[model samples]
Target chain A: MAGFFCLLLVLPLFIQGFYASLLTMTFIYIIAAIGVNILTGFTGLVTVGHGGFFAIGAYTTALMGKYLGVSMLPGLFAGGITAGVVGFLLGIIFLRLSGAFLAIGTLGFAFAIGSILNNWSIFEGREGISLPHNSIAGLKFGDVGLYYFCAITMIFLILFANSLIKSSVGRAFTAVRDSERAAESSGINLRFYKTLSFTISAALTGMAGALFAHHTNYVSSETFGDSWLSVDFLVAVVVGGQASLAGSILGGAFVVLLPYYLSEYRDFAFILKGVVLILVLLFAPAGLSDLLGRLYRKILGKIVRGQSDVSCNLRD
Target chain B: MFAQQLMSGIATGSLYALTAVAIVLIFRNTRTINLAQGDFSMVGAFMALVFFQVLHLSLILAFVATLISVIVLAVLVELLVMRKIRNADWLTLFTATLGVYYILHGVSGWIWGRDTKSFPNIFSVTPVSIGGMLISEAHVINILIAGGIGLLLFLFFKYTRAGIAMRAITDDVEAAQLMGIPVKFVVTLTWAVGGFLAAFAGMLLAPIIYVSPGMMDTVLIKGYVGAVFGGLYSIPGAIVGSLMIGIAENIAGGYLGAQYKVTIAFVMIVLILAFRPRGLMGGQARREV
Candidate 1:
């Protein structure tokens, strides 16, 4: 584990600047994917409107930096808090809605946000808002600096998710997901946990948005107005392996890097993503991580264990 | 002015109502909302363009051809993709449809390019005077056709064995299967019908909204809102709900500026759902063990 941590720490040093920054963007998406995994994967609620919360986060950070000259840290925090509060309120309203209704409600939320941002003049419409240079303690954030910042944030957030999932709260979330009535009968407060899940998920995505704004130094309607962004977030969670932290990492990298590599054929890229998503869901319902895990076990078992044991494990 | 907006709203509402009905039909049979429902219409509109413009077919022939092609596409979607995981959890089913949505969007963009193109209007744009209000001929035709289709569907649902089997399956899938209803066949039929209706709406809307890959997106959302507004299971409810949405949007646009109309409509949906969680006409929630 120490060695793994050391590798994570030193790995970016060897990569080119462009790739490092790309990886940083991947980290930001991974953060959002983790947020999505918690809500949709663990809690069994589907949100196709997370883009609204992300936009809120991005807009908050951009506005803060533009007007108040707030640094990166406070902007991130405020962005998260604002999104979390809005999510909490939405969760309250959504308590009675479930299944398809909730999905519609969330989609409506996204559309409402999109329209507001696109039409409202204070947001500067499509022109977008540019941030002042974000720095902390007189240390300016170059590409490397931003990369380290996002990486460190992701590590801490992952650790937090790991602990949260292992704790009693996580179990309650799972119970709620598996059977809402059963969870309620077992003395779990459905309202609290569901809202809490939404709050945490929205806050995490919000922070990702904040990081995104700082990374790009701009926030605009074009970036956050589309419902497609929400689809992409959900895709990342499912593609990565729903309900698994490791899957979020893999899923985030896949979603971000797939488009990057396919930049030459932009339209084909979408078709390819659709094909990949359908293939994964059809062949590997648990997602790419489960497929990768099985592959890893099979290869490792062949190398380290007797053939008989490997065959026996494979049978199960 | 109010009368004119109401007439126009009803015309657009009729299109939304059709899409909503398609949605309801699929949901009743499959228990999964087809996210690609709108794109089916998008493809249909493009097919109409080909048959009418490229192939130089007569208007009626082109219309018939477009509907048939769309129905086939929906059947293929069911057979190839949805059939494999018909009983999967909601998320899996939803994601699968999302995949189809992307494929349809990408394919249409590739085939047609991204530029918006005009659709040939079946009805001339000459304004007709009714009760001192000027309304376009297309609007009148759209309203009449939608009403006729709605009446036909009502009759079909009330009298047909296949439609009865669909409702039975919606009530209880296992019981319907036990009763020897060909569940899979019925589901496929429902998809075909859904595709037909979606295409019909697309063709009707093409003249108003123009033909493009994304033309059906907003309509889909609004159609969905209409479905939920009337209770997703009820056909009449979808019609009434969609008309309400159409009028509401037009009124909002006329009174509160055109730019914020969509926002107002969405806010109204949220408010309605908040107060009436099951929708105005939705059935009571059954307790699941």
Candidate 2:
């Protein structure tokens, strides 16, 4: 795992320009995917409106830095904080409903946010807003610098999520997901944990949006808060391994790079995405990470058995 | 002016009501909400275009063909895709429907292209003045057709054996199956009925909005809001709920701005889900836990 991350960190040094930017985008999505996993995988509550939170993060960052003239770091913090606060409130109302109803409600919430962004003059409506170049302490961060920054932040967030999942709160989230009644009987507060999961997930996703704003230097309701983007995020979380951090990274990479490779067939992309999602759900419901884990175990088992056979033959 | 708006609202509400009925039917029988409900209508509109505009078929023949094809498509989706994951959770089933949504949306775009095609009007384009209110012939035809379909459905449910079996399954799937109600067949029939209603609604709406892959998106969202607003489980409730939405949105668009019309549906959805989850005519809320 350490070696794999080292390879990722050094990847930008070997690949420059477009590929580097693409990798940067992948890193951003990886963060967002992990954020989604926390809510959907851990808490067992699917939200099709995380894109709304993502948009809030981006808009907050852009507005703060461009209009309010705040620094990049503060703007990013503000973005995450804003999205977290909103998620905390929305979660209270939305989490009351479960399953399909919740999914539809969140979907409506996303469209509502999109509608607000499109009509509100403060958001510049559909015209969108351009983000200023990010700088801190007299050091300007261009594409290369942004790539490094995103990679480091992604690594840190991954570690944070790893620790979080091992905590008691994480266990409560899993318990709720597995059986809400059982968890409730066992003294887990379903409402509180669910709300907390949403808040944390939104904050992480919002931070990713902040990075996206800085990287792209633009914010638009169509790009950020759209239903398609929400589906894309869900696709990433499901494809990677809903329950695993490693899965999220893999899923994010697949989502970002697959389209780049298949860019030649632009119109077929939607069909391909739909087909891929269906195939993944049917064949590997646990996701690609689980598949990889199984493969690893099989290989290790074969090697150990082969070694044991050789040793027995020599002794005989 | 007020009367004209009211008439138009009722006409549009009729369209939404049909779509809402389709949504409610699928939700009731399959225990799954088909998010692709609107996309099925989009497919129907394109099929109508192929039959009428391309092949030069009669309007009735074209409409029937569109309805049959959409019904086949819906059944195939249930049999091929949904059957495999029958035991999956609501989230999984919902996502599967979303997958269907994407496939239908993409295929329609591929076949019809991205540009909107002008759909031929089924009714005359002339307007008739009634007591100082001028209403288009299309609107009048739309209301009549919607009323006819609604009446037919009501009668079918009330009098038919298949309809009773469907009602049994919706009321209690396990009990219906144990009673030898042919639960699977009834469920498939429910999907067919949903497809029929969606296609009919699409045909009614095509003349006004034009035939495009993306045309039913707003209508679908509004239909969903209406369904939820009325009580997801009740057909009559869905109809009334959709009518209310139609009138409210038309008024909001006229008095406020047209841009805010879509937002009104979203706001209504949130409000309904928050305050009255069971909706106006829905039964008691059953907690999953």
Candidate 3:
């Protein structure tokens, strides 16, 4: 897996411009998916408003870079922090509700964010904001440079997420997800873990938004703040396998690459995506990651059986 | 101006109330939010367009056909998809509805093309003055039709056997089943009725806002907020909540600026949920274990 990712990272350098940009976007989406998975999969809280957080991050980075003359590094950090703080406050207010109510609340939040972005003058309203060139130490990071930066950041985030899920906090999250009452009785602070999950998820998503702003060189209300964007994130998480880290990467790649491959059938893309989501939920509820895991085991089992048969023949 | 705005707000609020009632009915019975509720209305509007505009049917005929088609679609969705995943968790069901939402949206776009279609107004466009206040004939008719439907629904729930059975099932599904009521049929019936209400609201809204694939997005959100604010399971509460939302948004648009109008619904949702999660008229908090 490590070797494959390394190859992917380097392959972009050798690929054409469009493919390179596509791969970079895939990486950015992977980070976003991981962020969503932490909240939805690990904590068992569904949010239809992460798009709002993403927009907040993008706008923050764009505004800071454009107005305050902050470079990309600090701008990205500020964006993440801002989104995280917002998420923390929202989670405190929203996590009290469960199931459908929570989903509706998040949806409303996403719409509210979009409305504000579309109407507010400081944010330039519907016209959107242009991002300054991403730079570090007076060195401008163009397309290739930004791709490398995103890839490295994605790799680090993946590792960090992996370790986080394996830690005590992750266990608490899973416990809360499975049974909140049981988790509470077991001495897990449900509120704390839930809020923590939201914070971490929002921070990562915000960072991805920062990267997206720099890549697109523009931040708009429609792109990041729309409720449909939140649904898209949900689709990616479910398609990849909600519970698995690798699922996020696979889901991100699937989502990003599907449009490219189906560019000719642009009109049918949404229908196809909807069909995929339904089929996956009905047949493979665990998502594509579980299917991949099963396939891997099956192949390994066959290889081992063949080796054993060859050894037995030699012994005879 | 205040009177006119209030009257217009009431007119729009009636539409929201109808949509909310549909949403509340489904949620009460099935425990699913039906995220595709808006798409259902969108499809209904298109169906009406096809009937009235393409087929050149009379207004009443077009309305009836649209309602029938919407009911069939809703029933098919319930039987084919929702029933198959009856035991799935709330989140899975929600996601499934979202998938359905996307499919409906895409199908409408594919069939109707992406452009907005102008719907011929069924009511007179002339304004009628009541004392010093002026109101459009269409607005008056809309309020009357919506109110009439609400009253009819109220009587149906109160007097009809199926409506009584539906209430029983919503109160306790297993208990209702044990009492020999066809639980599955009632659930399906509830969805059909929901479809009817959504279609009716959509047809009414088409003239004011042109029939488009995305026309019901804001309406659905407002309706959902209303339902939640009124308490998800209560019919009367949903209606009252929707009226409040309608009036509030109009006032906000008039005073604060039109841009801030939509944000009012969202802010209301957040504030209401934060302060009272169960909604205004919800009975008791049933904490999920």
Candidate 4:
């Protein structure tokens, strides 16, 4: 029933322009959360710095558009590539520092990018860069055109992510998360896989950031603030459920919409986040998806039992 | 000019180190960061602000009152809140601390109304001359207070029986529990001490800088940077790490630019963690079981 409602609600998004932008943000957040999920959920690598790659993407697109006179296509790919290279370098060196150290290190990387973005004159020195719409492969997406473009892009990214997880490579990533000690004995190069995950995750995040900068038409250092990065993207996965792509999208939707609907009680917004997150930590740490999954199983079992009882009565 | 910049940075860094040390003390004792440290300090500063404004108490009396209030707040918070989660998972505990942060931010905003208050001038504004290089009174006092706090903590930890017991528990809580130490009680005491340190640092620094509710938000970031750099478990490391980052930031800001100042600590830590994951002084951190 809930799924039916979701489909109904999501249907307008396919037809309307505003709902498209909403899903555009959701898709972007999906990329960021998936990046973080691969590290935290799959590899047990904690990061508070996905925003750094995000900023790198936004900044790259803005810079290319402003200075290089390059179109948004190259700018978007450039954003992902830049973040991917940096993530690869960072992963190769810092992959071994688990838990708190890893969390802090990622934070440091984000802070570093923050400093550069704030200081760099080409990035407009904290005033922020306004992005122009792209002319993609001679097909320009202006105004309402974002609706179809973003929806299709999100579908493709989700499919790609799904395929990646289904491969043996995905299991290898999960193995590292579960137990690196055992994985080492099984010839899994933990360091290599960890780096691969970081790079792949950053690329996705970069793409999302580029889309965001292009969509909103603004890119600034504040967009990558530590608080938002730590709270919104990281918590979205937890709030939505981790290690699942559909859950990632759901998490993205919640993070964006929850704050929007509760904007009237502005202060209550974060207070509610704290409360809900605490509940998630305590009773439903596996996430909304996991909670719903459990309820579904129980209801299904009851239905099966009731049908069986009716059959017995008919047999008698 | 170089010496002056370096000195000022170290002075500020010392404060970060002091706060980081207190945070480390709490983490070591109870395996929690006590997200309320910033709040405890802010509350103390606010208390001092009130004592000075309303009752016209001497600065000395205000400090004493502030310290007492901070300790009391710490105890109440632990008794009412943290004790319930003694056996919680690290992530759950982490979320709990974040809850504390949100609550503190809310309460502080409610009380303070997001205004910056001018703290009394603890020192004269004139620069104190040293070999013709002018050092502001703020810089001098900041360094002296930070150093004094560091020394006082060292003495408290090294010379007292309760301090040794705290150390013992920090090293091995299960063993300390088995050895007849009231480990839970000691953990509470650790929180109290940590609170006192944060409040003291906040008060002393308040007079040097302006007092605002969100002031510690940035300070906390710097303090965490200092803590991580110094090795979260090492008191001396916190001090050394704070000073190191402070100096590096000063040099970086002086040469590289002030816009990049905030990144120095983070950039430093990332490089260091990549090369030295256990931190500069930390023993090998155990991999997750």
Best by TM-score: 1
The weakest ten consecutive residues by lDDT in model 1 chain A span A307-316
- Tell me which of candidates 1 and 4 scores higher on DockQ: 1
Candidate closer to the true structure by lDDT (higher is better), 1 or 4: 1
Lowest-scoring 10 consecutive residues by lDDT in candidate 4 chain A?
A307-316
Instruction: Report the lDDT of model 2 for residue B247.
Output: 81
Q: Which stretches in model 4 have alpha-carbon errors above 4 Å?
A: A1-10, A13-16, A68-74, A134-144, A225-227, A306-316, B33-36, B39-51, B54-62, B72-82, B115-117, B130-133, B207-209, B284-289
- Please, what are the lDDT tens digits per residue for candidate 4 over residues A214-312? 888888766764545655677777777768765677788878887778777545666676677666766776777777777766676677875544322
DockQ of 1: 0.66
- Note the residue pairs that clash in candidate 3: none
Interface RMSD values for all candidates: 1.8, 1.7, 1.5, 2.2
Model 3 chain A worst lDDT window (10 residues): A307-316
* Candidate 1 clashes between residue pairs 3 or more apart in a chain or in different chains: none
lDDT of 1 by residue, A1-316 (tens): 3454567678778988787789889999999999888888898888888988889999999999888889999998998999999999998998887787888888889888899998988898789999988698778888888888998899889889989988999999999999999999999999999999999999999999899999999888989877987888889998989888888888998889998998887778889999999999899999888788899788878697865555443311
Q: Candidate 4's residue-wise lDDT over B147-206, tens digit each?
A: 887788789889998899998887777898899999878988988888888787778778
Candidate 1 versus truth, CA RMSD in Å, comes to: 2.3
Ranking by DockQ: 3, 1, 2, 4
Query: Which of the two candidates, 2 or 3, achieves a greater DockQ against the reference?
Result: 3
**Model 3 segments more than 4 A misplaced:** A305-316, B284-289
Q: Provide the global lDDT of candidate 4 against the true structure.
A: 0.75
Candidate 2 lDDT tens digits, A255-305: 888778878765576677778777777788888888787777667667787
Model 2's CAPRI class is: medium
